[model samples]
Target: MFADGLFILFTVFAVVGAAGLVLFKHPMNGAMSFVVTLIALAGLYALLNAKLIFAIQLIVYAGAIMSLIIFIIMFLNIQEEDLPAEEGRFKYLIGGVIVVAPVGMLLTKAVNSLPGSEATIAGAGFGGVKEVGVKLFTEWLLPFEIVSILLLVSLVGAVVLAGKRGTNK
Candidate 1:
């Protein structure tokens, strides 16, 4: 019962964080909300017994991504007045359709399905850090390296973008 209650609370926090992410006027506040949402998502993943995913969620998302976002925001020196004006109401209408249409279709299809999804275990194998290491390196190596490279590129790009203009050209 206690676990269930906490899970519900975490879910609420995550949803509120997501909404706040959209509604907040300040970029720094929005970034913090994104971190909150990521942490709550980690809790949700842990609740599903996917501890590896939970750790990855916290480390990769809340730690690395949020830090990068905050760094970029500060480097760019985003002020309240520098923020762009909100688009017209039709923009929201278009955004709503873009977001809701696919989600509505997916939900409708999932509900109409006769059999719900089920998890199937893979062939017997070692469980834990060693197993994950082998699996990631053996099968998912390319994507893993790609993500690392992507982060490095993002850091370099941020530095370049934030560098002061040349005066004696």
Candidate 2:
């Protein structure tokens, strides 16, 4: 019962945060709202007993990614005057909802139709950091390394572009 309540609370928070992210006019405000969503998702992962995922959600997404987003936003130094008037934004939002509502309903129905399974206790070391580390290093090493390299390349490219922009100013 406690877990269920917490789940509901987290779900509500996540939804509210997502809505705030979408509805906020300023990029910084939206980014802050996104942080709330990410943190709520981490709480949900904790409720699911996914400790590593919870930590990653907080650390990688809420911490690192959000900081990077905020940094970029700050670097851009956006002002209210710089923002373009968003005419017909509400119309676009309504149109988007109209297009997406059926897909949402279909997905909900599909999930509800799935077979229910008995709750089973996980084995020892299941979802533990060490076990996940071993699997990630052994089974998923190549893909992981490729992703790391890709991130490094992107980081370097961003730095180069930023440097070029600075020099141009």
Name the TM-score of candidate 2: 0.92
List clashing residue pairs in candidate 1: none
lDDT score, candidate 1, position 46: 70
Best model per lDDT:
2
**CA lDDT, every prediction?**
0.84, 0.90
Cα lDDT for residue 150, candidate 2: 100
- C-alpha displacement of 40 in model 1, angstroms? 0.2
RMSD of each: 4.1, 1.8
Candidate 2's residue-wise lDDT over 8-30, tens digit each? 99999999999999888898999
Which structure among the candidates has the greatest TM-score? 2
* Residue range 105-155, candidate 1, lDDT tens digits: 999998888686665564444335667888989999999999999989998
Output the lDDT of residue 89, model 2.
Answer: 76
Error of 1 at 34 (Å): 1.2
**Pairs of residues clashing in candidate 2:** none
Which stretches of model 2 miss by more than 4 angstroms?
165-169
Q: What is the TM-score of each candidate against the true structure?
A: 0.70, 0.92
